[model samples]
Target: MLRTRRVGRGLSMAVCAVLTFSFFTACSRNKTGSSDSITVGVVLPITGREGKPGQYQREGIELAIKQINQNGGILVKDLDKKLPIKEVFYDDTSDQAKSAAFAERAMSSDNVVAVVGAYSTALGEAESVMPDRYQVPWITTGAAASTIFNHGYQYAFGTLSPTNLLGSTTAEYLGTLVDQRKLTKGLKLALALENTDHGVDYGNGIKEWIQQHPGYFVVVFSENFDLGSPDFSGLLQKVKSANADIFLADAHLQDYITMHRQYLQSGMRHLMISYGARGPESDARKALGDGVDYIFAGIWWSRNLPYPQVKKFNEDYKAFTGHEPDSWYPATAYDAMRALAKAIENAGTLNKTAIRDALRKVQLNDSLLPGQTLKFGANGQINTPFVIVQNKPGGKVDIVFPKDAATGDSIAPTPKH
Candidate 1:
């Protein structure tokens, strides 16, 4: 029998649930009858603070596997035949230690070819080691911190936008607005960011841009808040007291929901507002209603982009999951799976080493991301830029920055609270 454990939510993240691969078979209450299946391991925080997006990543991975199997599965030239993918899903429950352990099990115990997992940088960073130790390729669909790639690991790979760009892009876009006089110069800027590597990178990137471009904005107040906080009144009070002209907060979905509620209630408004990567979520829009409108965010992918394949993917994703994507989480996961499949095909063999080599040389052009291509850099992280999105009234999302790909311009000086 596979062991299981229950964990509680942490300050910045939630609890963890450990479900061994056997649970995947048990969940469906069926046993596989063939050894022809190509096994893959999937670890996710399905029950914690990052659970919502983790579930989204899981759904996206499953959808891609279903499509791949339906289209004749994966070709193994060694056997001159195709094999359907069989996934063993593990619930890391937002526990980093448990995540790595389960990943180790997936490789050492379960005979999986490769692994896909982890929705947050913390968890992804934790599990990054199992790939190289077990000599299996690990593809991370959600983690984006550059630190995960800093270590010399040959087997770890990611499929999301890096944090530096996520922050710098937003800052650059804002600086451009101020340069055009659409926004005031030397405006007071307030920073409320999460206390994590992801948050640190975001803050550092923004601050670096500020240093490079003189006088576009001034950091009047800056502070880091613990993730998963239930209240933000104290923080908002400080920000309001500072009377910053712009407010930038880096947070997760739950934090975004909680803080934004208190922010509006506090009657603190800025010439521009951003919640870092935490804004533009559908749940936030429904929970806060018009409160989220006009709020901008730097994001990985938005369905509103003009990319032809992206448009088609929105339709296919809906059909596959019976729901529209909530945010950029799924798109990255979906593309990651496709990239893996393409690598397997290119390798022409099921040999793990060969596939790993193939991944290094893989370049996917029929992708749904803005870049229109997905290729891992030498450090195993993808080179991609984020888009700026604003939540418009009537539940519509628009691309507001980087005029070349923008669907609409930002509506500044957001309506007074």
Candidate 2:
């Protein structure tokens, strides 16, 4: 009887311990659930030609994330919970193949709710296929090609103005300068562009605009060059020989630095040299050192604008990044994050379809760009305004065109280098 009672007591103790362990395990799993964090995947050219801009964009996104988290995270009405954002990043290396692969991985392996990436048009084109296939909403912060929007995919969206709009807006600004300020009349135009979609689209837009206004411009030279050409001396000589009053070049940041340096060194003098979409980069200033003066660029935003929203964003961004925000990339990425948060809140769940549907219906008003309201069209493209900024003496970039929004007067015939 004694032996049997002892055995029974041992069995009872073992059963109690197992039950306690099981109960605690179940409780822990429930407490630390997948709903605790929201994952957002970011893909960018952390290497190659776009490396610098990509780094800038990443920093901006991180700053937005930090600010959002500090504000008590994103609220989920369905779950009645707050979810912190988790960023899963991949380097596309600015390669098309790598971009496609990264997109696949971001969608499948990371299982991210949405993706932000592909700074270049080439990379954007390559990665676009996967998002539609996977039904993931892909927000592009830098790629501005119209083809990205024409693909008829509801899942893809770009925060930047399309190249067509950028090109025409730039030309229109130049026309205003010529007509109102009498900077130059019957201007002779020259075009030099990189051999990429970015170049082609801008070139087409310019051609269309010139065709629309025949007597306003005379095309002296139209040419395209390979990106990252080590020396732009040959190109600069061609541009000089053209002797066009206004020279327009569509190039990336590195190319902008290289070509402009070569232009200044080669003593090319035009009444106006407008660099499309490449002037907001600090690299240009670093490389040229006063060479960038008098050059105008079509941009999406500028810090010098006098507005409460602009001031607040500039101060907050400077506090976070230790530098002022550039034209488009960072602001676009920041807007993307805020838009994503709104979609998540509206959807009330982490379901991709619901989030996408909600995103399509949402209208973003707190954008950094003035007079611009962001709403996704059925085709997943954002319609926004473009601004013109001229680099003034002493490293000041002031908004000179769009008269109603002008921050300073136009400085034309930039002092000869």
Candidate 3:
């Protein structure tokens, strides 16, 4: 009788251990299946010098999220279920340090699968390092500096094409104008660029173009200015003395307004004026009135693009945001979000490594940029063509370059003031 009782007790203990192990295993499976949402992180400057553009980008990201959720979120093959995206958004207040910090917090604390952020080149540079450190994918909607991608980091990507392309495209457009006899060959050019990675790339691109096509242009004057200068009178004086036929500046939106205001006040005029990617902002129009007219910019996206996707995006964006996009800022950002979402779906799981790998293969077929498709190069940057848009009188903007996509005529030689 004693042996029988002892054996029965041992059997009872073994059965309990087995049942406990099975319970935990079952819970693990349910945990994967019952995930409420797939979380993504977003960090952007919503309130500083970069604020206006940043806000537009934020809206673009939010709009894409809304659309994705409306469709029952992304489908994950591992879970055999669809999970809505839960965005963990933060404002870096236009500070580069803060941008990096927020990105770190998102990955370390919020457990985000991916991050999108830091709109400008400088800010993006600050946040770019966080992706590889945390082993999460990051996509920058605005930054175009090539330095960010050359670091051998596998997790970082960008929607904006390299800044050098903007410079080269501008040179190509001007060369065409010279070819058409609208502008003369050997025209002296003046470059006033913002001192940053962006500026360096822009200047190099122009010089490379000039080197390849000798006699098309001459860099009679080239100078760099500190960003957000309270006064540009000193620089403007030097540019005026250069007596160049073309004045090209790579400036942010605010700097464009301030510098142009100073340029107008200083009575400086060039046959052709370009502010890199700054011509069509409504703020510039409001601040400079008729002065901003005839200015051209090589930008990543334009509302003037003639595509069905672009038209739908414009209408949908206006309805969602209660205002039309001021420029190319929002479109790149919107595409960035869509690209990330596509990557997640392609990954078919919330695994960070899988998503990072999948991002390399994502191809957005209905992209709203100059090209209808969006794909990343080996460097994880998009190599889309930049559209050169010129501001016309009475608030009209025209796409003048890449002749096939021209929406309105290029007012070459820009009717000297």
Candidate 4:
């Protein structure tokens, strides 16, 4: 009888041990499934000098996220589960110090796998330090300074074309206008740029291009002005006095709108060209009207691309924002999120290091930019083509340069008001 009782007790103990182990295994699996949701962070200047572009960029990111979640979320390989992505965004307010602080906080506290933002070059410079320290991949859609990539950090990626390429593309398109339309011979060019890294990069790019094609361009005046200068009369007068045939100004949207209005009021009538951050903001058009006509800008993307992907994006964007997408700001941010999604899918894991490594290898097949496929270099910089857009009468914008990708004929010498 004693032996029989002992045997029964031992059998019960074994069964309890097996049951406990099985319960824990099930719980562990459930816990991992719960943690599979991926989180991404965005930092943008939603309140200051960079506010307009920031809003555009945020819209793009939101759109991409919507699409991703609608399509059944990101696939996690290790767990064999599909997880939705969660986005956390902060407004940098266009302040450099604030941008840096936000970036640090996002990386450390929010525990984001990747970060996207810093619209201005100054803001980018400030926020870049956090990515390097934390090993989180940082992608910027607005900032275009080459120095950002030159930092030797593998985590920094810029979807927009560098200012150097923008400058050259602008000069090239202008030269075409001069040659084809016989608008001006030996066109004297003047550059009035905001005094910042963006300005310096654009100015240097134009100088390099002019040196390479000397007879085509003659730079009569080159000057840098404060970003928020209220009165551009003095600068416009100098440009007018120089007799420059083409005036190139690199400025942010607000400054672009302000100075261009002032430039018109000052009666300076050279073929106006603004690169880097200029675009067709409704406010600018409402304020300047025909004055903005014929103004050319070199930018990352254009609504004029006839590709189906681009058309869909444009239509969706207009539906959401009640405004057409601008060239650089929104498109780049949209691509950044899509690219991040691709990296996560390819890595099959949420491990930061794996995603970072996979990001380098990820290639986007359905990009909105015409004739531009998305691929990252070792330094995380994207090599993409740019478009030159001319603001036409009746508020029409047409992509003029790069004949192969142009959607409409070039409007040269702009219509006289």
- At residue 213, candidate 2 shows an lDDT of 74
Clashing pairs in 3: none
Query: What lDDT tens digits, residue by residue, belong to model 1 across residues 1-417?
Result: 122232223322331223455566564444333448788889988898889999988988998999999998999877789988888999999999989899998887776778998788889989987888878998999888878888989988898878978888889989888877789889889999888888888988899899999888889898999988788899899999998999999888999999999988877778899999878888998899989988999988888889988888788889988999888888888888888888988898877888888888899998778778999999888987788998888888889877888988788778764
Q: Per-residue lDDT for 294 in model 2?
A: 78
lDDT of 2 by residue, 18-120 (tens): 9999998776565334677888889988788888778778877887788889988899888899988888889888888998999888887677888987788
Which pairs in model 4 have colliding backbones? none
Q: Where is the poorest 10-residue window by lDDT in model 4?
A: 27-36
lDDT of 1: 0.86
Q: Give the TM-score of candidate 1.
A: 0.90
- Which segments of model 1 are wrong by more than 4 Å? 1-35
Instruction: List TM-score per model, in order.
Output: 0.90, 0.89, 0.92, 0.89
TM-score of 4: 0.89
Misplaced by over 4 Å in model 4 are 1-34
